[model samples]
Target: MKNLVNFKVAVKTRECLVQAIYQMLFNNDSVAKVIDQFKDEHKTKKVDFKMFSMSLRSINRNKKKIESILTSLEIKNSSMELIDKSILFFAINEMLFGNLDKPVAIDESLRLSKKFSSPESYKFINVSLDKFFKTLS
Candidate 1:
């Protein structure tokens, strides 16, 4: 029998989107690699690969800006986990580059954190995103 645990059923949630973004970034060195990696997994879910691709592109495009913003928020500490950093990068990319709503972005980031990271990380992610938003106005 196939391992059901590896198969994620179809669902549209910010967490999944963010996860996809993180996976695409962390697992692959190029778009072709990402597509190859996700090709099998995505068959079980109705994920918007286009959206994930766009997010990846956006993040790469604004990589410098995003890094500067994160640095400004003092997130350069090596203590942070890679998952937490991915969450922050996804949240920041969607909020600042994609023009997603602040509340929705923050809430989604929190939800993602609750699922993927520690409870303690939610507050830090929220406050950090909030600070980044403040710079926009």
Candidate 2:
């Protein structure tokens, strides 16, 4: 994984990552198109493109595992909205596969939930991650 915090960088790196994941979720375009569209639509002038790119790659590689974790956490795909599902994908990928810290993953997921999902959906994000991580221990 890329060292996003190693040197001077934009603070919205995490946001851009989440946005890329959300784009992958909602848009029917290919990953390349979604990334290009995200960058073009958001006017991401200073965003860390590596962060978004690596996150999308990780999410795509472990997509089945991420979705399986979600199912084990009882977040049924049929019951959840697209935004919440996207949050799960991003957070789980970070927690399980990416190089980010666990708390950072949870916190960023909550932030994304607040921004893109229902207010109360953050609780589900928190609880699900907690449960999933606990099982790993």
Candidate 3:
């Protein structure tokens, strides 16, 4: 597997990635359209198409696993904010699907939580991931 840390794209770059995902999830856009829009918006903006493509593919490929993780964590119907779900979904994507190293995945997820979520969100994410991993053992 590739080094997931090396695969760690910037938060802003990931914001673009998630935007494409959100478009797909919320707007029902096709993958090609999402990629096209992403390219048009960031073609010359130093975005890593490789990372963006990989992350997008990861999310799409692991949708079921992500959903399972959310369900397993019992947050599927909880009243937690969307940001919380986003953080958990992202972490689960990395942990249960991405080929990145486990520590790298956790770190990247925490970084994302810090950047895009509330301060307490990281702790919540960390605990959730820890419990999820424990269930795997």
Off by more than 4 A, model 3:
1-12
Q: Whose TM-score is higher: candidate 1's or candidate 3's?
A: 1
Q: Is candidate 1 or candidate 2 better by lDDT?
A: 2
Q: Per-residue lDDT for 135 in model 1?
A: 80
TM-score, predicted candidate 1 vs. hidden true structure: 0.78
RMSD of 3: 4.3
Off by over 4 Å in 1: 1-13, 24-28
Q: What is the C-alpha lDDT of each candidate?
A: 0.70, 0.77, 0.71
Report the C-alpha displacement of residue 105, candidate 2, in angstroms.
0.7
Report the C-alpha lDDT of model 2 over 23-133, residue by residue, as the tens digit.
Answer: 777765567887787678766466677777788888988988888888887777888888778878887888888887888888777877888788899998888888987
lDDT of 3 by residue, 26-67 (tens): 676777788888988888775778877887777877878787
Clash-forming residue pairs, model 3: none
Per-residue lDDT of candidate 1, residues 1-137 (tens digit): 22434323322434555665566557646655655566566657666666666766777778688778789888874887777878888888888777567776777677778778987988888888888878877
Arranged by lDDT, best first: 2, 3, 1
Q: Flag clash pairs in model 1.
A: none
- Candidate 3: global Cα-lDDT? 0.71
Candidates ranked, most accurate by TM-score first: 2, 1, 3
Worst 10 residues of 1 by lDDT: 2-11
